[model samples]
Target: MDTLAIVILNYNGQSFLAKFLPTVLANAEGYPVYVADSASTDGSVAFVRTHFSAVRLIELPRNEGYAGGYNMALEHIQTHYGGATYYVLPNSDIEVTPGWLDPVMKLLDANPQIAACQPKILSYAERELFEHAGAAGGYVDWLGYVFCRGRVFATFESDQGQYNDNQEIFWATGACLFIRAELFHRVGGFDASFFAHMEEIDLCWRLKRLGYEIWACGQSTVYHVGGGTLHKSNPHKTYLNYRNSLFMLYKNWPADGWLWGKFLLRLILDGVSSLLFLKVGQWRDVLAIIRAHFSFYGRLPHLHRQRKALLKQQKAEVPLYPHSIVWDYFIKGKKTFEAIVETSEK
Candidate 1:
């Protein structure tokens, strides 16, 4: 039997769990539902234990963010139940649809080459609009800028059945990612050092490097509250985004240009982007970008070792947009997915 486990990693998101967990259990009738709580002191563990008798709650000793939380939780699961064939990693804030698992699992089962996939993520507050986290699928530019198929920067497209077709993609959103358990473990799981943010893209990049495809199961859909752990505009999230992005690029090596040179350009562009924050006196954000670069530098030695080890098994060129997403999105005002889709072919 092909056992699939739905593991939701949560960190002090009791409200989200209370709001969405019932729907998850209702929709996921047969499959086992697990809530891996990341040391949430807000009585999340007690709440789950008291209210949700059906959920298999695994309370972590400490908060290790998303990467470490899942790594630890999945390991615990593997030991306890001999593990499932597939794992569905969902953020606590997502409200899953009925039969959400079928299309994604079917796609994965039909294609052994596909290691991971995600359902279409519509905004929980604005149901008609695609969420910014993983709008359709996700893509990274040659400069390591990660964007989604139906989202460019902050622009979230409305779900008009435009991206209903399933297709291969560079990365799946961790907000509700479905991945083969074997492949997930085989890839060493996520880089826990990332803490959170961009870790999914990093994992997908490694799988793609091994000749595995990541996909968007547009047939399945989920509503995400988006940014349960960290709000989109939070400075810490900014730090993680910039720093983990650098971490991802270093670990997965860009398709062109020297890594440092590209990073230098990224630094310049990041500085330029900070002008927006500077205009509004959000110095913490400007400082967050600066801090991200320093963190990247501090981790270089360890990252270099990781790069060498990871590349030892590399088999394929990592897929990335050949153009700079910054230039296209900002300079040229090509704010839509359609405007940039043609660039992939050119």
Candidate 2:
């Protein structure tokens, strides 16, 4: 039997952990589980130690965001569990359905070119609804926005038979990404600069450059409670989502007109969005967007150097069609964000 190491990054999620740990442990047969705690104040460390004695715990001194926390935990896995053939980065708020891992591993075993695979993620809270974060698989737009199958922004509908067929995708969500340990190391793992959002996309883009395929297995499924740790309405998450997207574009896109063209388009859209939010008095979101732009600008030089180095290492350019991934997100005549704010105020 091939060894597997499950790396779960925790941050003040004791409440979820109470339920998450048991479900994960039950599904994690023939695998070792590692809980990487990011200095949770809510006795999360103690809870895990008491309940999951067999699980390895790596408690950080302080919160190092998502990327840092995972990287820290990965170092231990690489050293101690070097024999692990598969490495799973599962979020702490997910419940693995029966036979989820077997399908994913089987696909990876059969397809030597496939570097990573993700399970069909369903919504935990909404039950019948597909999870907004990463419904089945993830894809990106030319404008650098990320969307998933069975969902696009607030347009999540019933699964139906939309994504029943298993196929290759541009990227897989980090929430439940499974990768071959060797390929993960080959592409150098998730970019730490992202800190959180879109890091998986960045990693997958790099893996594609190295001649690896990312797939979504329809047979494997998991339930994810959307916004379990960070509420969707939270300004902090909005900021990270926006900022990290820009960082991703800079790092992954070819260092030429393509990169600048996309970056400029994002700038225009974000600027308009900020103004629109201000007009409607969504002050927190507006401020969050501003902060994200300024923070990214501050680190432009370092980001440029990193991009140059990464581009040089690329062995091949994977062609992705824009229309295949570009989604409207505003389905069924849904009200736009501005309209929602206006109507709410009225």
Candidate 3:
């Protein structure tokens, strides 16, 4: 019997905890549940302790964002519980379904090559539509853009059994990631510097680069209420997504003559996006992009060192979408993921 521990990292989300934690507890009857609070002053820790006493609690000294908070919490789990075979890191806002863990667990157990996997994530609000964070499974395009099988840019596909087949994916949703315990530590876990967004891709890409597979088990499903912490419109979330995307590409993409060109292209795209925001008078978003660029520039030295460290590890040629997602979506008017994939195949 494989030992699995489900851990949810919370920060000032007492209400989310109040609503969703019960569903998680009800569904996860056999496995132990834990609530890792990131020093939230909103009494999240107290609420968990008061209502859901059986759910183990870890009180982090300070809020260090998702990457750092999870690292600390998982480390504690490894130390305290003797080492669970699997770790399921679900967001505070996720509503996991009954039997959700079985398929993903079976997939991981059946394939030693698979390091991480996620369930088919639908939207909590719509229930039938796929969510934005991760619709089905994620893939990295030629331009380092991450899109899901059920979503493309802002266009989300309805739950019409389109992505029902279990398949290999480029990345798993961090909203509810299932990872092997040993492999998580072997790769040094999530990069704490990522702070929040795109950290899952950074971790998954490392696993992918190291020749380990990430998977999506279609048999299981979860509903995600995204932007629980930072709304999509928040400039800070924009900064993290844009900047960490650059960071991920910088650290993981093979260092070659063409890598610089790709970076340049991405920069131009970022600038174009800022102008679009400017046209709409989203001055804050424009500043966020500028700030993201400058922040990346400031971290170049650090990223260079990190890149060299990654090179020291054994690597394999990771699979990529091999097409320009931006061109296919914006120029060719391919809105759905199925259309993009069909055109790529042709």
Candidate 4:
């Protein structure tokens, strides 16, 4: 079995596969590459089969979304390639550079403590800027608000080589995440219920709780065309992001007094976000936020069960940004990551 396997999850991304597959295959020298198709009707599987015949294709029966699709695909990988050390789960809409996997894979190989990591992700269209999904690395605020070293909320920082150092982070962007194969299953893979957005953060949070490090390896890099599957402007993406963020906090945060206070504060922040959406006349987005909260409330029982199961297995402390990222980015006008870090230091 190959020590590493690069698996791209695809839905209806025929164009992306046709365009980016060559770069992926070229950079994936000495590693097995697989495409896990989520039963796309757009002839995505057939195209891959016809053109990239060497690339292994696993066709699922239906579209289970990213979370479920990866879980299912990884399970297949585990069963078949039990000796494989690492799995790279990249989005279909990514373009990799030469030697892109070396730095991150080498880091993981040397450090068993690190369960997962991602390379520096830049924007494909705008090469100078960090990508929204994962700029340098991902981190979360005290209230479960996720942002990256080069991205804070909607504001993205340009690539100035500020985050070049490989460092431990709260989460690795799923856009091009490289994870230790065995540990991925051990921590109980991504929450299938989430189905999509914020699932990577939840998985990383779980890994962190289990005393495993997640990191961003800046020595290697890739470009991502964000919003390939679900565009940022779509209210459905907003809804899933909002609902899943709450679900993540509920399932992972400690059951101590700290939980309720943070949850309430996050709710208030979410309300503020709703108001901002209203100001922009994004009425559907506002309704999406409201619906997200209701969905969170409805799933409390399931989330509680998950929390109980997780807590029973691990009691490690997961790191979160000491300050509120929302306040820092919006109120304090800290746009770039360097600015935020500098402000936090003061």
Question: What is the model-wide C-alpha lDDT for candidate 3?
Answer: 0.92
Tell me the spans in candidate 3 whose CA falls farther than 4 Å from its real position.
none
Candidate 4 residue pairs in clash (backbone atoms < 3 Å): none
- Greater lDDT among 1 and 3 belongs to 3
C-alpha displacement of 281 in model 4, angstroms? Answer: 1.8
| TM-score of each model, in listed order | 0.97, 0.90, 0.98, 0.97
lDDT by residue (35-113, candidate 3, tens digit) is 9999999989888888998899999999899999999999988887776899999999999999999998889989999
**Global lDDT scores for all candidate models:** 0.90, 0.79, 0.92, 0.90
- Which window of 10 residues has the lowest lDDT sum in candidate 1? 254-263
Give me the displacement of residue 329 in model 2, in angstroms.
4.7
Compute the lDDT for candidate 2: 0.79
Show model 2 residue runs off by greater than 4 Å: 323-346
Q: Quantify how close model 1 is to the true structure by its C-alpha RMSD in Å.
A: 1.3
Error (Å) of candidate 3 at residue 231 is: 0.6
Give the number of the best model, judged by lDDT.
3
Instruction: Write candidate 2's Cα lDDT for 5-85 as tens digits.
Output: 888999999988898788888888758888989999999999999989988888877777777777777776787656378
Clash pairs of candidate 3? none
| lDDT of each residue in 1-346, candidate 1, tens digit only | 2389999998889999999999999988599999999888788999999999999999889998999999999998898878999999989999999989899888988999999999999999999999999899999888888889889998888899989999899999999999999988988899999999989999999999999999999899999988889998899998999899989898898535587898888888888889989999989999999999999999999999999888889898875788988888887888888788876566
Q: Which candidate is the best by TM-score?
A: 3
